[model samples]
Target: MAEKCANVNDSDCSPAKKVKLNDEDAIENTDERNTSENDATPETELNLSNFKVTKVLQNNCVRKSICIKGTFEDREGLAVVLLEQKSFPHDESILEKGFFDEKTLFRKHFTNDIYRNYDCFPTEEYNSIQTTVIYPATQNHIEKYKRHELYMIDETYELYQQVTLPYIESKSLSLEWITNILEHKAEQESIIYEDSDKDTGFVLITDFKWDKQLDTLKLLALPFQKIKSLRELNASHLPLLRNIRDAGTTAISKKFNIPASQLRIYFHYQPSYYYLHVHFCYLMFEAPGIYVAKAHLLSTVISNLELMSDYYTKAVLSYVVFKDSPLYEKFKSRGALETSTCETLDCK
Candidate 1:
């Protein structure tokens, strides 16, 4: 059984403990073996020597691999390695089960500390280390939104059209932003992919905030249509998801040289802008707004629409709002929300 840390927020936990695995077992299980003194084969030792350890996690029995190291390889781009103690149990290893095997373990043990800064393993040799992007959602929060707040989404849609849509139309804002990107005024270096079409095309640009480290590829999908957020999504809008996923995945794969399975494509509710756009990020990069309260996987959205043509029309969606958000104010005014703090609202 995995042991729980007393306080995950604490910085001074005990150093990762070392245990002894049988030498024969270590040699036989090369794929699951750790890059430690006890388990490192000649080839593994040579390859890992090039990297330098940069971070360590202590007093975390559940975390066998606490040290993370990185170095730029001559041909392999950036190579990152997680150093694990040889004595840890192979059966209990999160990597052996799958990246998202246990939601609580993934969130509490894997996401909190040193792992946040390290890149997902650079090569198959380091596959024993797994990471995930989705945050764990509390059952209470999900149930509360489902029961009381989902209906407000419909009201929020009307508010968006009345207030936000006019501002966007008057300024011709998103179009101008796209023009700036094409003209090289913004995000020139970050343009990983572009599908130019005057009719139904879109551009994929790197988000300005992404640092490009740790597989944090934050690409924005700006569609040609001025559709405003998921509220505008319906059967007709479903095709946009396919086009963006197909094109975005291909481009990102070419750029990163990774399979499409390593990527996560989704959209956020109450996007910063009113324009309809999508987000393309690595599955291991925990970019903001990825919680269940706000993020909706594009694939799920498409399937929902396929099952019900007017899915968005009748479906109750849950979204989060900050205390000062105008949308939150709208819900509060209508007596749909009791508080202005960051809370989830359900809209139908």
Candidate 2:
């Protein structure tokens, strides 16, 4: 949830004050392991039964996360309740507890406990949440949590070399980690699949966001080639693309037992980082940045390259640019997307 910043000096909005509030509200209790019934030892359940949901801010079933904008029946104003099922630790012993189990859930602090959610896994905890509820949630809170305006401007082959390319180069970002991974200096143990073919080679590693879970699985395939994002891919890169599409799929099937049918393999245009990488996640995962406006399917990319050697080089690509994105300022400076629709998806 966004920090409701009215004025930085506002006592209620101060980080110090929030920390103090969380400290006071922290629920001190032993791990209430596997309680199949209603609670007896109560500091209140932080129940949402009375929350009158006026709107759903975001709902991603793949990630088991939901955000709702609403007000409690007993409350006077709006509120935002974000509840997401906590991730499991990678520890095999704790991961044995599946969705079939009888288990109890605990929210460490009545207000802030997202960090403590992981502690419950070892206690046979099948589900828990690091949730946040912003009550009397003013329009300010709603605006902060509200989805931003996304303009899908079409970038042609000319626009790439002229406007977008210059804009991208102007921004300085770090990729030392990418180098470390490719050189085998980092994340050595986490690499589940690897190919050292030099040109078409890549190491498939587990993404931090996914702690080895099946449903919300996330894996990244980083190629040894120095090719930056999808923009750099052309006919000559078909081998690398096909390797990622075919070999990565086979490796995932062998390692995770997830069939090719159940996976979403794609590349992000205007990727979070400029480095080239392929993302693989459970089809149901709905991981961030998977919207059509950003994600280009690996299969589709392969076909595009197969059909036209310079498909990406000469293609007109439509992609979203968030207002807060680093690329946003660049686009604004160049008047790059000046004519695109600037519609806002407000919570109201």
Candidate 3:
């Protein structure tokens, strides 16, 4: 569930402070059998076994792990133990070498496999796999939006700074995934479209989405800088859009052995992420977010910006908000949307 940011200026908008654990209690609970040869005694051995199960995390159907509270002896502060389900039995050798040390554990465990899987597979092979299947929006969702306006241009950047930025900085989900893609997968896999240069401008990468089961190619045009949604775009970003379209068309067509005309390039108003990105999918595929109220075609966006420099900036664009969305409530408070009659769907 997403948390609502009541005020952007408040300290509540900042990342949540992590709780500190007592190190002495944790060290005292270390099992004697797990102690290293060099430090077998209680005084010498670093006790790590005194962990209290704080949370259980489940990833897909295949794996689950416990998040434990503890502190490493050598480390200055308290830490959390993310116990990953190992394929092999607990290895004492790893413990002796400090493999599960705070720093090492953080580096290894704090990542999503959905993003990391791109690194393991060849780009062509990865692109071919059907990883996601999105269901069409229900009548409930349709009716809820019917009463409320979708795009709140004025609130876009404010919501990003308050809600999105803090989550990325503290939770390290989308931000980390993006960093890994740029660092590990982009260049080697031909995913990079334009590297940010002083002359040409902002960095952009074009890559196929993990889900492409529709028997047609779908690509993503992601910008490196933090620009929240299409609402933030203006004439200044025209070059970036053009580059993305040109580069994306060439890359997708060549890789999939299809013509560029078959592709439909567009942008979603209320994107899943705050970062500005364009979507390129097969024209034949009735993609989930392509409706008039939700999607704005890239060609149209570019043309609009060209005609009026502050078109998006000043324009009152319409976009959908579900009955359950906090944004929906916000709109209701401002009387931008009528009180909804449709029931909120079980979103998760």
Candidate 4:
């Protein structure tokens, strides 16, 4: 019978390793290893599960070897002994204990109260694979990662989506085109309003729905004829300010302490802005590096915002708010005032 290979990567197969099926035939087969294959015998099932600790090897590294079994279904019952960085400086013979501790330890504190409910999945890049599947941990966040973006899974084993800031990619939607679309959309939908303060010099105000899924304002364009140079907005404009803090080891320096350098512009809506407070807090944590700590800090802060922000105000104006509007949600999650109570939208 002819044997077939499936699911396994090409690198795993070689002519030298092909199984001799019969007197004259050699099969380079990668058969389905699913547990449900009817042909698999009970004895085979027992052997599959009978994984035992075989060997542990560590060379020229600060950490020791850990070996386990049954964790990997495809491998020959030998599972790698993964250890958290905190567990380092341990005894090498500890591998004989059969199982390494599976507990996770947090080195630094989480500022969910000050920040909000935010989780960052570290990025994993495979040059061979050209697709990306975004698995956002929460419904509130907009997962923004492209196919070619470089990423890595950190010690926490979370995928971080790498982003290049000041990455200026301009969509074709210009102010004039956006204005036309809004005007047409407003005429059709009676709910929207367009106001131009002729006396106040070309300042146009358009209001529409706020889309929660897209995290964007439903309205296409702001009525302002021309927005001048935008500035880095402070906390005073929007009462809801969620600040994320993660202190890593390398960040300890003189420049960051005197004045916090803004890390990234997370949300920008006219005068209202939200930034990830990475520099100050991350430097203080004494983390080995910035990547893991930054992701943890940003994720925790966003998570906190989701819990406190008044959903009622955000709910009604959902249509006007741009769909997938990360900016609005960033502020709302940080604890925005009740839509009814906050009369002043003059964030600028």
Candidate 5:
């Protein structure tokens, strides 16, 4: 049962500009993608050939993963493609002529790009939130973590001031992308609901990964107020939480024709960014941050606030910290994690 393609190079299966539809980045590239041998995500179905590039939002060709975020012709959302450039195979580098020099390789393979003043020049510089997982959906990896490692974080006001506040203030995160979308500067079509409540107002937008598909629905609702993370929430912020759950969810369901019952609404404790936002995804869709370690149910947060005015302000939050996250080092230094090393968690 060994069928062979006459010219593998020309075959559809052959590696042709290997790219991936990264869930973290909210875009998809297809066919073949390069990855560290152990970590492989499920491949999504998207035909970028039909996509006509209108603008290059970001091109991080220098990072560990070379990615380019862009806008496509007639397409409303953003699309990110990780150009797998210089990761050339060793055998392919066995030059049959003059020895390979830096200049020769640069001339032959490197792609030159020009960035604007405000562009996310070296994409590695910014930190963004992500919810999907590409890891093999094995019962062991998923089920075991939920049973053993998941812990609820009770973030007391004192703990937040001592631990969380300092780390956020230290890292000057770039909020240019969020700011652009809110001010009608970018991804205007992706906007689902624009709450003009001022104090509790927010702009909800669909995830770029959806690509107009509703099967695996996704969205991000950014609050207009600079509330930072869930730790800042109290009963006073109930309007924001409830608005996201009700108005936001309703918009998604009505626009997409998806029922509200199928939606899973929640917020991330240690959100990828310093900005306060809510995540809405299909209940059947299990993204990376949906786990108890990170995701806090929107309804649960509402209920907790209703019970006590200062529930979140005085709660003892318990959440996971990856071995590689900057927060992990901060927590370890302050003895917040209860161990010098984190053996069970992932590497951020």
Candidate 6:
């Protein structure tokens, strides 16, 4: 199994120094936290009320595989990637079966590699070797990520290099950072909406004539998680969405808290490119009576689809946007979606 690392606030500490905390120590720490919460003092809350700790200590955090090493020809199709830690809120219960809480511990390494980062830890199959690390549950910065793509660990390093496969450890952004970043982006550019005009409801419904032959395209909402290109979207008779300055799922979810049902998603095809436009009502989750509406743009699926003569397939990628949320802040920085380019309020 791979080696585990400790979680510590290292801003003031030296780089090479390492702190060791065994499983017993970790369990004791958890117990201590539980005990403190049980007899919580009001003054302790006051001490942390103003001072927010951005850095999380790595302990029982989850690791995600962002990039996989090796090609289909190398490992017969098995991809290799790295793992990084994730921190959750202390109050949230760590359940046995759920998303993001199942994985714990390291397994065996692939033939030539030293460490293996599996999707889930402690499974009977891959019990060779693995590494697990956790972080303190307070850090919530989104844009501070290390991996943009799975193979592209270093922002400065290109991912075109070939490497041995079998065992893999991905180098991606911490799950804490990814979650916060996505949440932050959603909060910022998501369109705000209001239900004040339920009497004068939407009228543009019957215009969309569904064509059976055009392919039943179920366009998924935006902020494409691991998808890097349009080909990966796997939509038929449609195109991928890109240039997500004001369009993305994260942006919409953060802004309104309403599902994608709140927006009008459409497809447009140009001679050279395809477009997806998401029209939404800009209503703040906090201010339900007030209504806000906006339209966001998405770019072509493939930058150079004209060059492909063989003609593989097509798909549509839908983007949803909301206003003023945590996701808004994160996307504003990543250039995924922004509020500055939105049209003026027409509901006035």
lDDT of 6 by residue, 20-115 (tens): 111111111110012222234764332212232233322222232221232222212222222332222233343232224445553444545665
Candidate 5: count the clashes. 12
Instruction: For candidate 3, write residues 10-109 as lDDT tens digits.
Output: 0011121111211111110000012113334665443454333332211212222222233454544433433322222144764434443343322233
List model 4 lDDT by residue over 1-348, tens digit each. 112211110012133212112222111100101122233486554332434434322211222212121233443322333221222113444432322333322234356767644332222221111111111111221121101112121111010011111211211112332333334432222112222332111111111211111111111113223322112222221222221111111121121222233332122212111211122222223212233212223333344445534321222121112212443333334343133232346554
Model 3 alpha-carbon miss at residue 69, Å: 25
Better of 1 and 6 by TM-score: 1
Off by over 4 Å in 2: 1-84, 87-148, 324-326, 338-348
lDDT, model 3, position 254: 49
- Candidate lDDT (C-alpha), each: 0.50, 0.65, 0.46, 0.23, 0.56, 0.25
lDDT of 2 by residue, 1-348 (tens): 333211110012222111111111111100111121232255534467888878876665555666789877765777788676766566565555553235634345444545433233234445456566665565645654555555556788787887778866764544676776667665555666677778888877777435445777888888889876788888889988887787788877876788999999988887656678889889987667787778899999988988988788888998876554445556666767763443334333
Model 5: per-residue Cα lDDT over 1-348, one tens digit each: 122111110001113211122223233211111122223244433445645443332233222222233444544555554333222223434432213433232223333586323312212212222222222222222222221222233456786898789888875545676776668665555565677567777777766545333556788888788887888789989887887787776676656667778988888877766788888888876554787657888999999999998888777766765443556666656666654234646646
Clashes of each: 6, 0, 3, 59, 12, 63
- What global local distance difference test value does model 6 have? 0.25
Arrange candidates by TM-score, highest first: which order?
2, 5, 1, 3, 6, 4
Error of 2 at 297 (Å): 0.5
Model 6 residue 144 lDDT score: 19
Comparison by lDDT, 4 against 6, better one: 6
Model 1 Cα lDDT, one tens digit per residue, 7-91: 1111111122111111111111011112224433664434443444333322334433332323434223333333333322234
Model 6 segments beyond 4 Å from truth? 1-158, 161-169, 172-220, 223-297, 306-348
By lDDT, is 2 or 3 better? 2
Candidate 3, residue 345: how far the Cα is off, in Å: 21
